[model samples]
Target: MSREKLLEVKNLKQYFKSGRHSVVKAVDGLTFDIYKGETFGLVGESGCGKSTTGRTIIRLYDATDGEVWFNGENVHAKKSRKELKKFNRKMQMIFQDPYASLNPRMTVKDIIAEGIDIHGLAKNDKERTERVHELLETVGLNKEHANRYPHEFSGGQRQRIGIARALAVEPEFIIADEPISALDVSIQAQVVNLLKKLQNDRGLTYLFIAHDLSMVKYISDRIGVMYFGKMVELADSDELYKNPIHPYTKSLLSAIPLPDPDYERNRKRVPYDPSMHDTSEEPEFREIKSGHWVLCTTKEFEQYKAEMENK
Candidate 1:
């Protein structure tokens, strides 16, 4: 991963009106940067605002506050129709559900070619067909399947079609919102491997969001952990796994089941207690190490520093 920042999210907030008087904060005060050519994994349990963060960054939802910068340009600012179209072509998203994301009525070829048509990437009908075929093959599908509908394919295959559709626009950055969670366990690894290969071949950058910590560590160069709509920790993948400073992070790490039978039998689960921290002052995101950050109050920050020194 280079130092060049491909995407930056600064104090982003998204709130929704729940009933008559309540407001639900789906994503609140998220700040991070994704370097060029790196996979930045955002992981947390369900309802942690992981998926909402991705959607807000991509402008699927209008941010309630703060800014999003993509390649040094503000993404949320009002732009002309042509500029928005250009922005759309550069940033594409692969949604979580393979079944609901695609149109059951459209054939595979037309589905993938929709972007190509909108962007006017191909000059003629022949060029469009050839481009669609190439994209289908790029995503592990053949031209023969192009004529088939979404109902004819399985979950994993439909996901590949979704991937093909995203690539049809030749996007620079992709927000993969739990792309593999809907597939079977056996098929999940296959999709991940394909994504890895595509990143290597196409020099793509990703914002990979999911709840599975082990799978995230496999593909992420750096990671950010969220809880209750706020980031609790951020660090390099290996460092975060080896030395988790936050209580919530430790609890999350402890919950990951290993493959070893003996280790699994002896493993201890750490239940996170939210009340363990001091509540006199609100916690802020502070750097505990050069690359490791944790949401902690001033007193906890010093204690964490001492804990690291003792380690």
Candidate 2:
């Protein structure tokens, strides 16, 4: 079944001018749509702007150019504080660092009530406290922990608190910027499972950003691979794992560890050299197959199509 697009990002560009007069093109000319009730994973290296893209979509960082339309409404354009407040309640973010994201001085109950207070969802102090307890329970935490601070919990528990905070607003769309990266390896799956359960129950739409390609594939229905500042490939999770066309995509796939010890030792890592591709002409994202998008120049796009056909 086809899903409806809840959010659309068109030609989004984020660039920062450095001291030397050179610009750091954090996210350049990227365009993609996230469907409602589905997880769209954005993966790449640390400096590839995966986080920047997520930040820009949520209006944490203003875009240098382009448009982000949520439910056909332009989010980047200026709006009254009241209008922006409504948007904020609908779209929430789960930051990457559990330790840094939460306020140490604030109790969990007060932290969760931040959104409820902003939107005036609760009528009184009693209702707000009840809402906070409900959110803690929803994220798999006990109600007794509500009085505790961020310093009392482990990394995994801290992330769960972050999740609870994002859910406090009862958002329709969530931008999870590596929510599980800061947690322990054993606890990573727990958080992922919680996110999946929340999606099933709440029908939440997500733009999940991560540098860990394997984790992204497991949670995301569709995945987009970004390079230094541009999207290089996008396709269904299974299709991308089986057939990665771009040099950067292939390199990323090759780096994932194999289960078999023998195979892992012998696996050849592909090095991505952007200079190999002809870039005199500006590259554009083209559909190389049904729902499979790739960034390439005119000649390279044709070559990619032919290569897929031969296979």
Q: For each candidate, what TM-score against the reference?
A: 0.99, 0.98
lDDT of each: 0.95, 0.93
For candidate 2, list the clashing residue pairs, or say none: none
The TM-score of predicted model 2 comes to 0.98
Expressed as tens digits, the lDDT of each residue in 46-121 for candidate 1 is 9999999999988889999999999999999957888789899999999999999999999999999999999999
Give the runs in model 1 whose Cα sits over 4 Å from its true position: none
lDDT accuracy of residue 168 in candidate 1: 96
Worst 10 residues of 1 by lDDT: 78-87
Residue pairs with colliding backbones in model 1 are: none
